[model samples]
Target: MTIVVAYADTPPGHAAVTAAVAESRGGEAVVIVPAVRDERVPDVAELEGRWPELAGRVEVERGDLGDPSDTVIQVSQRLDARLVVLGLRARTPVGKLVFGSTAQRILLDATCPVLAVKPSVAGP
Candidate 1:
């Protein structure tokens, strides 16, 4: 089974990748789909360099879709992924109301299970 990740270049995005790796059962492929509009997709080599566990098993899939949320859903469905992992960042109520949320849409629209994670906070 494949694990699809909604990737961004942020703390939350890194956390999502970490969570996906942890959730993997050794043989499952981890496919990353950029989840932020206009954000560049990370090279597979770069990703493997950062997360050694993902070496040979990680790939980037830039679907032929426009919206980030739509692309995520489309890739997950196309791959029939076992899971979809994504990260969450805190947003003000006003900000959420105004901008809406891609994460929220993916969580609701994905046909498979979705794993949502937040960055680990450092303690004082």
Candidate 2:
């Protein structure tokens, strides 16, 4: 079963991915990082620096942006994914008022079930 986990340069994404894999049917997961324009994607080497500890848990597959929500939805439908996993970042007061969160977008756009996780820690 395909499990698509939304990844960012944050602990939430990593923790969310871990949670998703644990709850999945012990299948390989594809980690997707939506890289917009030419610079938004996080350096993979840095991402993997710590993730190697959990590397055995999944098969990572990154996705560069073509619209994060749209891309995730398409990937889900095409892969027939069992679940689309993503972390719901704590929205800032201004952010909540201005733009919606990616987690919300994914939840609404994905055809399959979406698992949203929020990590215990966060970054500024």
Candidate 3:
């Protein structure tokens, strides 16, 4: 079984990756799908450089779909992934209503189980 990650370049995104690694049972492929718009997707080498434990086990999948939510769902369904992980950032109710929530869409649409994580808050 494989794990699918909705990746973005943010603290929440990093936390999701960390959570995915912890959830892995060794030898399960961790596939990353870029989950932010207008952001460059990190190369596999860059990902490995950031997370040494992901070396030789991480794969980036840029799905053909346009929307980030659609891409994540499409890739997860295509891979028949065992799990889909994504990070959630706090959003105001107005923001959610106006911009809509990619995380919410993924949670509702994904064929496999979705794990939503938030970044750890720093202590004062």
TM-scores for every candidate against the unseen true structure: 0.98, 0.70, 0.97
The TM-score that candidate 1 achieves is 0.98
User: What Cα-based lDDT does every candidate model obtain?
Assistant: 0.96, 0.65, 0.93
Residue 89, candidate 3: alpha-carbon lDDT: 99
Give per-candidate clash totals: 0, 0, 0
Give the lowest summed-lDDT range of ten residues in model 1: 36-45
- Give every collision pair in model 1: none
lDDT of 2 at 90: 72
Runs in model 2 lying further than 4 Å from the true structure: 27-65, 122-124
The lowest-lDDT stretch of 10 consecutive residues in candidate 2 is: 33-42
CA lDDT for candidate 1: 0.96
Which stretch of 10 consecutive residues in model 3 shows the poorest summed lDDT?
33-42
lDDT of candidate 2 over 1-124, digit per residue (tens): 7777766646677676667657666436555545221224445455445555335444445455457666767777777888888876677889977975667778888888988887876468
Error of 1 at 123 (Å): 0.6
